[model samples]
Target: MKILGLIVEYNPFHNGHLYHLEKSIKETNATHTIAIMSGNFLQRGEPALFDKYTRAYAAVKNGVDLVIELPTMFACQSAEIFSHGAIATLNSLNCVDSICFGSEEGDVNILKTISEILVDEPNEFKIYLKKYLDDGMLFPTARSLALFDYINKYNLLDISKEKLLDILNSSNNILGLEYIKSILKLKSNIKPYTITRVQSQYNSETIESNICSATAIRKQLKDFTNIDSISSVVPCNTFNTLKDKINNNFDPMFDDNYFEILSSIIVRDINILNTYFEVNEGIENKIYQSIFTSSSLDDLKESIKSKRYTMTKVKRTLNNILLGITKYDMNNIKNIDSIPYIRILAFNDKGREIIKNIKNNSDVNIINKFSNISFSKDDKIFKTLIDYDIKASNIYNLIYYKNNRNLLKGPMDFYISPKYVK
Candidate 1:
């Protein structure tokens, strides 16, 4: 009954991921492992290297017992919301015992302390936070400085501002803190665990042996004159999956002209740009003007970015617009605790057992077939979230068509059934 939960992207399963999985299992001494993973889009506001199903299957086959999906709307979001969505989904399951994540700051106590501070949001902390924010510092920078000052002022736990800044600088540690914060905010029973990331730096763009970052792996794939080159990093099944994909002309999908597609949609009404998530503060005009000269995604991002707007924000905003997820929609739906249903992506025997346990205990519907869904079109809240996922799937197919040389057999989401591995 000790079911360990994990939140992951697993963009394409690799040795680093495998090691984390093993370590989590060993540390927890858990009988089952469940992962809630991102769909086609990732938290970084980019498409995954492979589709969700492929990555999920890769996870279940390797070490994870089961894999569910974090829907597209939350998948392409800021770190905090992304963590919130995932943790909420796990909470809904009512069976996960503990959650484990990779972190540069491997101490769960340290991350948990940071999470508690964030959740409490002391008045002094708020004062410094607003002070830095009003001074025009980015939210992350402001929050980091505020927390550092607040902690140092109290002289709590002998933690220095320099050490706290070092913790904030590492992306994995930041994400780990968010996960802990979400658990505390929800007051959930799930315990948090951290596995120290071994060799790969968070979001590093270089590949070194098997333990390179996913960012590095994607970068390697981009420079992959030979598709087989990645075999050293990913497992045999993953290597073969990637091999067939590449050989059949669907290899390098992450690189494409999403800018034109996004622009074509954005140009329809510049004023409507503010409607999408992250398209705030009168940034619509900048986007509309940028679309005309921007020949690529990078070009458009560079054009739209300002001191206030990071490239990740620009990319995510454009992605939200293209996918038809609006700021209005998110604002209305952000408080939802129960995501209407759970979509199972892949499972093994151990995973199947957990599914049975979930069905008997949780109220959330479990969907294995798209046709079996039972929501009314009039339910704008449910429709907006679910439709975004479906649309994102279809749009990824379009991206595939643009990236690949030949015709696709079909989009995996459309044709592939939920994978059940014995």
Candidate 2:
């Protein structure tokens, strides 16, 4: 069984996602396909356009055989850690033979070369990196400039600095490089494949006719004034599901209410802000100053963001704070082996066969039922992990109406069972 593993956050199952799924299967000759997807929260430190279950079901209905949740810790982090956890989870399955991801460059060799450079971190690169950091540039920008400097200094691969910048700056290519770096770090046997991204771009916010980006689709969803053109980009499954959600008044999450609600939560526990993961460089103090003054998430993030900490970092820190994920809790589980468990989200008939095989083959625990395993009273690490997952779910539900909040209890998310979809 040549199982293909995919790292995804199908914030909504759109046309681009469907295209990638089809191309992945054909390109890899995969017998089974599995996705380790983000749950209700995304790497951007915002709630997914829709809930995980709906998104997972849409994935399976489209092409994915099985869907598993990427834990909250990794899901709401930067690209490097997010890719690390995703690669780790895919590797844990043991039965997976290859992983396929979309990339801007779309060349496996080019992606591999970049990953090698990142992993090796030549002395020249480090010196350049340090020089930029010392100049007070943010880590990402500093890293970018350092890459350019190192490429120029060594003339590595005879590739121009400007050309390399184009590849590195592309969002999917950055993730693709990190994915390769993680695989190299693990010395894993899984093969990697990259498919060229098509049509709309990663950050494009306008809906095109046939191949719009998810970000574009989201913009249309956010403004329901004219949605007729959305069908051109999203599949019937996604379109219908979104329509159902909209008709039921569940489409207001992107509105200002989320930050309004979050503000109330932040004010209630301002003193404990520093304890959460990613709250550093006195960012907690800035958040404190903004919590009472800022009216929206944008306003709060604007107040907290600085030259050292990017806007994404500030938002990610807020996500950590909202869910009570302490830095101590994260530090205790930095080792890849410390990722305690994996939660199955949804699966089709083919997925059931894979699950049966996984029981005998997987490295990590395959959680289908919540009650089967519980962290003992003394296991703070595991408890803290599960605690954040539950808390994140509860907060994600805040986007829905009051009565619909808390739809899934702690056990339901962690213990009850993975949803079986035909």
Q: Rate the local accuracy (lDDT) of all candidates.
A: 0.82, 0.79
- Per-model TM-score versus the true fold: 0.93, 0.90
Worst 10-residue lDDT window for candidate 1 reads 405-414
Ten-residue region with minimum lDDT total, candidate 2:
407-416
**Every candidate's CA RMSD:** 2.4, 2.9
lDDT of 1 by residue, 350-421 (tens): 988999999998987787877666554466766777778788888777876555525545544545678888
Q: How well is each residue in 354-413 modelled by candidate 2, as lDDT tens digits? A: 888877887567667666557442566556666677777777775554555455343336
> Could you tell me which residue pairs clash in candidate 2?
370-415
Task: Show the colliding residue pairs in model 1.
Answer: none
Stretches of candidate 1 above 4 Å error?
A: 127-142, 153-155, 375-380, 401-414
